[model samples]
Target: MTSVTARTEREVTRGRTRRSLVRRETWISAVVLLLPAVVLLLLLRIIPTVTAMAEAVPLGGERSPWSNFAYIFSDPSFLNSVWVTLLFSVIVNPIQIALALALAVLLTKHIPAVGLWRTFILLPIAVPQAVSAIIWLVMLRPDGPLNGLASAIGLPTVPWLTEPGWALISIVIVCSWVGVGYWMTFLVTGIKEIPSSLYEASALDGANGWRQFWSITLPGLRRPLLFVLVADTVSNFLVFAPVRILTQGGPQGGTDLLMHNISERAYTLGDTQAASAATLVLVAIVIVVVTIQFRMLPGKED
Candidate 1:
């Protein structure tokens, strides 16, 4: 019996050893396959970032390293652009996330023509942003269909794109129209991943729809919500085409966002160094805000 037990132990040890060797070889093969792509990613991302940072620093005898940054801060138009970008981000991020969440929840319900409605909701995402901006520009013009309808209804004929304040609001509407559907897809996917059994059990416990949503859906969507917030904030910060095509950062520079300002600096004024500095500022803002979000968002520690 002792000899039989010893033989069994020897076989088990040999099996573990073989499995370890196979796992090691598989890991090595995977790394070997992935190394090229990893190197390319670093070359594309890190090298450009380092180069841009170096360009931003004015390396001369008289100029300070932060001279570009100083010039940007001193420029009134640039300051206004920063403020517009921040205000736009603050307003649009919540609206988009909330609207997307609401739509995602509604779609998950058994409404009539549900699939068709979802298709209609997502159709805006398929339209290119530039095309959408042009369409919106036509509609929001002073003599456009929207104003015509307002005139018929005796509502005031308001300026949409011509004015500074209205242009920013119009831009927000356009962004929400284009972005909510895309964000909704992520939320719907997240909601679907949650087990239905939880809802069923909650219903049995006399929990209503709102209660279930608060207790289950909201908690289930922490990661997805975080992703949407960060991504949407970044996208909104970098919005360029609509402002360029519609407002051109006009009406006293009201809609002059960060990206538009950066482009104007880089392309129009031939100030690549200033643009690089502005890019760094934008990158820093994104990093700090995203880091704060990461810390504040719910997790296992919380």
Candidate 2:
């Protein structure tokens, strides 16, 4: 009996040691897989951010960077970029979120040809952003197919990309076209994760479709909505490609986005310090905006 007890104890000890060895191996493999991504993020995001702040401070520079912020603020071109960026954000974020929500709801239904519809909606997202912008740029030109169709349909020819106001609006449209479908994917996933029982219970309570959406859908989607809002805002804030490729910030600087403004300051005019300062400012704006979004959204319990 004693020998049997000792044998049992030995088996238990061997099992625990084997399990510990396996767990250590798993953790080592995870770290090995993650090391490259961690290093890349540090190099690409963190290092650049810190370097930009440092460059903007002007510790050993000839001219005082004390005026760098003042320079960016006082400059008319920079101010216009700020205005353009804000306007774009205000218009595009809501449009994308609303359309994404609507599409997500529709896609969740048992409709005919639903798979095809989802595919078409998601086609834009599969295309690269720069490629999408170029495609839209071509479509919006005066001699483009869009105007041709407009003329053929007896509608008035619209200036999609030329005029100052229209150019900004065009940029918003282009960004929304690519962003809406991408955001819809998240909303749809969130909506589906909501248990079907909740909707059935609400239905049994005599709540209509609209009521269920308001009570069940909206409350359940709080987290995804917050994510989409903040992400869309950040993306639109950093909008550069449309302004660069299509309008070149033209029609009297109408589409001079903040990123373009920073690039011009740094590369075109050889003002790295000012550019760095503008970058820092842009980062600050993004941080504040995202923080506000988080605060405004309903918490998990709510």
Candidate 3:
């Protein structure tokens, strides 16, 4: 009896060793196959980032990257542009996220023509940002369709692009309209991944649609929500096209975003060092925002 027990233990141990060996072998093979992808990413992304960082830090008789950064703070216009970028992100991010969440919930219902509705919502993603900006620019012209409709209704044809105060709001409206659909798709996909069993159980417990969404759906969608928040924040901060096409960062640089300012400084003003420093600051700000977002998320502590 003792000998038989010892043999059984030995067999179990050997079987475990074989499984572990197989897993290691499989992992090694996978890594080997992934080597080319790793190399490509390093070359394309990592190398350029390092180069940019190096360019941002000027050394010796050359305009140091630090000086370039200082210049941004010293220039009142640049400081105003930074503030504008922040305000734009703060105003647009929550509104866009809320609209997207609401639309996701609406579309997930068994509404008529649901497929068509989804297709329409997703169509904007296929439209290029530049093209969308141009289309909005045309529509917001002084005598464009919007003004025509306003005139027909005996309402004022407000100066959307020409007025300084209204210009930023116009850009924001266009940005939100173009962006909401894309973010809504993410939320819709997240909601679809939730198990129907959870909803069925909630129904059995007398939970209504809103309750189920708040308790079950929202918790399950935490990761997707985090992803959207980070992405939308970064994208909105880097907004340039609508400003360029619609307002051109005017009538008094009200809509001049960091990217637009950086581009103008680099190309138009021939100050590559200053532009590189500004670009680095923008990158750093995005990283900090994303980090804070992730840290504040519920499960991030775990």
Q: Over 4 Å off in model 2, which ranges? A: 1-37
lDDT of 3 by residue, 31-102 (tens): 999999999999999998787777777677555538767887799878888888888888889999998998
Please list the residue runs of candidate 3 whose C-alpha ends up more than 4 Å from where it truly belongs after superposition. Answer: 1-40, 62-65, 300-302
Candidate 1: global Cα-lDDT? 0.92
Clashes of each: 0, 0, 2
The model with the greater lDDT, 2 or 3, is 2
lDDT of 1 by residue, 1-302 (tens): 99999999999999999999999999999999999999998899999999899989968748899999999999998899889989989989999999999999999988899888888989998998899999999999999988999999999998998888999999999999999989999999999999999999999999999999999999998889889988988888889889999899877898998999999999999999999999999999889988888888876545
Q: What TM-score, over all chains together, does every model reach? A: 0.86, 0.87, 0.83
CA lDDT of every candidate: 0.92, 0.89, 0.87
lDDT for each residue of candidate 2 in 79-150, tens digit (9 for 90 to 100): 888888888788888898999999999999989998788889988988988898899989999999989999
Cand. 3 TM to true fold: 0.83
Candidate whose lDDT is highest:
1
